[model samples]
Target chain A: MLIVGGGVVGASIAYGLAEEGAKIGILDAEDSDFSASRGNFGMISISNKGFNNLAYFRLSYASSRLWPEFASTLREQTGIDPAFDLKGKVYISVGDREFAAHAEKVAEYARRVGAEYQHDILNRADLRQMLGNVRLGERVTGGSFSPLDGIAEPLKLYSGLLNAIQRHGGSILRDHRVGRIQHQRGIFTVEGPWGSLSAPRLVIAAGLGTPDLASQVGISVKVRPQRGQMMVTERVEQSFPYPVSGLLRQNPEGTIMIGVSTEEVGYDDRTTVSVLRSLAMKAIERLPDLGSVQITRCWAALRPRTEDGYPVYQESHERPGAFVITCHSGITLAALHKRLLPQWILGGRKDALLEPFGLGRLQSASAA
Target chain B: MRPPHDLPEPPHQVSFRFGDEEIEAWEGETVATALLASGVMITGVRAMSGRSRGPYCLIGVCHECLVEIDGLANQRACITTVRQNMKVCRQTRLRPLTGEDETREQ
Candidate 1:
């Protein structure tokens, strides 16, 4: 088996497939590639997902639930801890109106999800009590906590998966971005400026690079780049009870990770001062104590967002064994991809959860 | 270890209080320099690991010299100019916040 794009998504699938005794080779891009897997907030969030699409929500929730075992398994295999923390996460609001809107949105999500949805609308006092050491801004009204939401150290998780892949006897080819792909007689040949490799089966899990390669194998992956800017503050003592959603969280190392903005700036991943300043302003407004904290660094990354903001999982009808899988929430869905995707790729029974994410839906919607 | 450079004495000196001890500093020298000159090398303990820390970069870049000055926390000693009778304390990590800071004594 040959997998293209050695980001978390590809590395995860390769690790999973290798565990099933398949000889695997993963083609990763250069170190400087704008890989979202390396730049995401590492949020294992289930709240506020699938508001318009129920299937996506279920997929995320299932993956979030599968994280504990996935983290432990990776640790056991590679002896590297991914630092998966599932305590809970919250989304803070700085005003009465914002709090009302946030509360209503959480309520709406609960209504849409029916049972299995758990969250709490914490008032300002409750939020203060929860964040014991930290002081909230005066205008900070309240926030919502979702028990299933959490975080993991993204770099550690990625490294652990890569280590596990190697431990399972999978070969990793770094700096081998495939420039061309040819399929003939049930064999797929991938060629690049660096070298060439062929396998009977192929999976393209590249983030923004999926479309070009997917098209060659008879799959038209419709993905665009969505830029998100983030900031990191100086290392400080962990004060929050748990991660406060994706907007704010202190990593295990003590540095506070703050982010992010959604912008349609094509493939540019440059941090803007305006965006950084606004993020800092918002952060200070929500947690006034952070106003004095020095910002250590800031960066931007591109999310491989599909047209409908949902993941695309499909095999090429033209090329029988070729597959394309891409998603924005690579960290959140990595567990599912590792636990479930390999089986389907190896001709095992397809999970019904994957039904709604196929390319057919996109084609039908466009056709209609 | 690199040998220390010799320097001429400053024209004037100032005094400041660093945790119950009054230390002498040259008029133009920063707090970190004064602390080092007075043989007070270990300025504070790291918040996370409780490791003893002192002035790393005397240019106010490393943030290793952060000490509490006059009840204000996270003041960089490398950049702070010493004044007479200024009260400075080791900037301990959040004690009231976590309440489990085992490194407070360090």
Candidate 2:
């Protein structure tokens, strides 16, 4: 088996296949590649996902549930804890209107998914009890808490996967920017700057590079780059016991990770002062005490997003055994890629769970 | 460690203030280098986490050497040269640049 893109998604899949005693080879781009896996907010989040798409919600929930065992397995194999935390997640609302909307959304999601969805609505007092010592801003009225959502150190997780893949006898080629992929007679030949390699099966999990590679294999992967700017504060005392969604959350190492401005800037990963100021203001509005802390570092990363902001996992119809997997939520979906995706890829099983996430759905929707 | 007596003397010495404390600096050295030479590691406190941070990369790439110089916030200490009587204050939080500040820059 051969995989392009050695990010979290590709690394997870490679790790899975290697664990199953298969010869796995992963070709990674140069260090200069704009990797989302390296710059993500590191949340294993499930809340506020799949507003209309239940399939994505289920996939995310399944992955979230599998995280505990996955973290343990990686730790045992590679001796590195991915810092997987599932204590709980709080999504705060600054006003009554937003709070009511958040509540309604949670209710609707729960009704749609039925008993599978789990969350609790909390007032300001309740939120205070959960977030010890961290003072909330006066405008924060309420929030929704979900036990299923959590966070992890994304870099550590990626490193653990790489280490495990190597330990399991998987070959990883670095600085191999895959150019052309040719599939003929059930054999796939991938050419890059490094060299050309052939395999019986090929998986393209390259983040933003998926569309170009998939097009060669007759797969229309409508994945584009959506830039997100993030900022990190200096390491402070551990404040929040659980990860807070949409607001600032302190990492296990005491540094608070504040993010994420969604912009449609094409391929530009430069941080602007205006966007960064807005993020800082919003973060300060949520946590009043943060007004005194200094921002240490700021960066921008491009996320691979499909048309509907959902994942695209599809096997090429024109060329069999060639699969393209792309998603913006690479950190949250790592467990699924590591645990379940290998079965579908190796056994050629038509998984009903994966049916809704195919490229055909996007094509059909476009046609309609 | 190289002894101070064995090392060549600086071409010129400069004086500066870091949060009310007087310090000596080399003429060609940056503010970050001066702080490091004086054993002042914790340069600034983060706005969101309230944690202390020191210069990580000595180079200007990290932006870990952010300090307020003469009331101007968000100045990079690693790139800014130290001058005599330079008032260097560690930035505790991000101060939003106002319209007047932008106009001043213009």
Candidate 3:
């Protein structure tokens, strides 16, 4: 098996395939390329995922479920503890209208899919009791919580996944860019700067680079980049749990991380005073104690986004045994890729759950 | 034949450009960081508000720092370093997705 783009997605898929007894080799792009996995919010999040896309939701849920076992196993094998925290999570709304609308949105989505969505809304008093020392904005009504949600150490997980993949008999060739790909007689050939590599199957998972590569194999992802910025504060005392996103997350490291502002600025990932100040100020508002907290580092990353903001998974209608999977929420769905994609990769079975993600809706049937 | 001993270089690097504007940047630095280090505050303007939004998070998580590089629009310049002779442009608009152009319905 040949996997291109050896980031988290590439590594995980390769490891999963290897676990299923496939000879897997991953060809990763140059590290300098725009990568998202290393800079994730560390959340195996579900709130950011909507119910309209059932494939994405199911995949995210499956991955969320597998995180506990996955992290433990990887840590044992690679000695890289990802700090996987499955303490449930919340997303707060500032106004009543937004809160009601969001509640209705997820509720209807849950009913449509017949999935038991127990995310609930709590008033300020109830919220205060659940999370002490959180100061809500004047119009801030409350938030929604999903017991299925969790967070992890993104960099550690990325490193651990790569290490575990290596130990599990998978080879990841980094800094080698695949220049082109060709297929003949049920074998795929990926030509990189080093040389030509052939495998029975190929997977492209280079984060933002997935779209152009899919086109090379007669497939299209319609994937794009959306910029996001987040700040990490200095390590402090562990104050709260259950990622206080849209406000803050008191990480296992005891640092209060906060303020993830999303912008659709093609791919600029620079931090500015205006943005950094606003993010820091907002974080301080949520936790008054954070006013004096020092920010250790600030960063911006590009999210791999689809036109409709949903993941795209496809087996080439034109080329058999070749698969392409792309998603904006990699952390939320990493577990699913490790557990599920391996089956599809091996048995050549078109998963029913992912049928809706085919490319027939956008590209020609040949590309789907 | 010509030397200005009375003046310093003002400490600048012109190794990159965004559109017609010269985005002063340094070697071995990501486009985003180089832009910030040069005091270039705002990135692309918002689609709805058209107001200037600078880099919020230095990482690619917030999607606040996306700029066009070469012909590629929406490349995350934070992780993308400023190679010599690279082109960077701030992308500032919204495009709707057509059903015929995608596999899944948006």
Candidate 4:
């Protein structure tokens, strides 16, 4: 199997395929390439995902459930802890209006996902109790906590995945961005400046670089870059009971990781002062003590999102052996991609759960 | 080469407290250099790993010279100038997660 792109998505799938005794060669881009896998918040976040699509919700939930075993397996294999912790996560609401909206969203999720959807809508007092260690700002009305949500160290997870892949006999070709992709005579060949690598089967898991390569294999992937800016504060002894969604969470090392603004600014991944200021202001509004903490570092990364902001997992119809897998939630779905994707790729049963994620939906929706 | 008489005079000495002991340093020297000059190596221990860490880059980039200045935590000792009677404490261990008594689980 030849996998293009060595980001988490490709790495996770390649790790899975290699563990199954399949010969895998992953073509990773140069260090300068824009990679969301390296710049994500590493939230195994289940809540507020797949609100429109139940399949996505179920898939996310299942993957979050599988994180414990996945993290442990990687730790056992490589002696590197991904720092996966499932202390749960929360989405804080500042004003009464936001709180009401959050409550409504939680209620809808409960209705749609049924009994297994574990979420607790907390009032202002309840939220204060949950975050007993940290001081909440004045406008902190309430929030929702879902035990299904968690966090992992993204860089460590990426390192662990790549290490596990090598440990399981998978070969990774770094600094080989695919310039030309070709399918001919029942084989796929990926050409680059370094050289060319060919295989009987190919998986295009390249992140923002997927669309062009996927098109060569007759797969239409409309992936675009959505910029997310983040910052980490100076190391502090403060800790949180749960990672607040899109706000902040104190790492085990004592630095508080705060993030994430969604912007549709083409492919530019540079951090801006405006976004950083707004993010800092928002964070301080939620946790007033953060006002005193110095921001250590700030960065921006582009997430490759489909038009409707959902994952696209589909094999090429023109080229039967070619598959294109792309998603923004690579961290959350790494477990599923590792555990379940290889089965279908190896000509086994295609799980019904993945059916909705195919390009067929986009095709039919466009037709309509 | 310039003559020794042309060389500028060294700055006068200033003293600071590093924990219980008093350390003297050149007036313009940083807290990290002052501590190192006073033979107080292993300035602090990493909170997570408990590994001994001191000023590595001495340019305030590595953050290994983090120490408490006055009442503030995580001060960059390499950048802070040594002041008279300034109290510097090696960050031995992380403070409790919440407050004085309670600690949060990882």
lDDT of 2 by residue, A82-125 (tens): 99988778887889999999899889888998887889999999
* Lowest summed lDDT window (length 10), candidate 2 chain A: A359-368
lDDT of 3 by residue, A249-305 (tens): 876535667767777778787767887788876665554555655466788877788
Candidate 3 ranges beyond 4 A from true positions: A95-110, A113-115, A133-139, A363-368, B1-106
- Between candidates 3 and 4, name the one with more favorable lDDT: 4
lDDT of 1 by residue, A1-368 (tens): 99998999998889889999999999998988888986789888888789998999999999998899999999999999998988888778988898999899889988999887898999988888888778888899899778878789999999999999999999999999899999889999999899799999999999999889988988876889999999987666676767776578887657788887889999899999998888888887887767666687899999899888898888888888998999989999989899999889997567999988988878533221
Error of 3 at A4 (Å): 0.4
Where does model 2 exceed 4 Å of error? Answer: A364-368, B1-106
**Residue A339 displacement in candidate 2 (angstroms):** 0.9
Question: TM-scores for chain A, candidates in order?
Answer: 0.97, 0.96, 0.91, 0.97
Q: Per-residue alpha-carbon lDDT of model 1 for B1-106, expressed as tens digits?
A: 1123454643566799999999987776688988987888888888767888899988878888888887665678999988888999987763232222233322
Q: What local lDDT does model 4 show for residue A153? A: 95
RMSD of each: 5.0, 6.3, 15.4, 3.9
Q: Write the per-residue lDDT of candidate 4 for residues A1-368, one digit (tens) a residue.
A: 89999999999999889999999999998998888986789899888788888999988988988889999999999998999998898878999999999899899989999998899999888888888768888999999888888899999999999999999989998888889988789988889999998898999998999888987888776889999999987787756767898778888888888889999999899999999999999988988777667788899999999978888888877888888899989999999899989988887556887888888878532121
DockQ, all models: 0.14, 0.08, 0.02, 0.32
Choose 1 or 3, whichever is better by lDDT: 1
Off by over 4 Å in 1: A364-368, B1-106
Best by TM-score: 4
TM-scores for all candidates: the values are: 0.84, 0.82, 0.73, 0.93
Model 2 chain B: weakest 10-residue lDDT segment is: B95-104
Give per-residue lDDT, candidate 2, residue A323.
Answer: 90
Q: Could you tell which candidate, 3 or 4, scores higher by TM-score?
A: 4
Candidate 1, B67: how far from true, in Å? 7.1
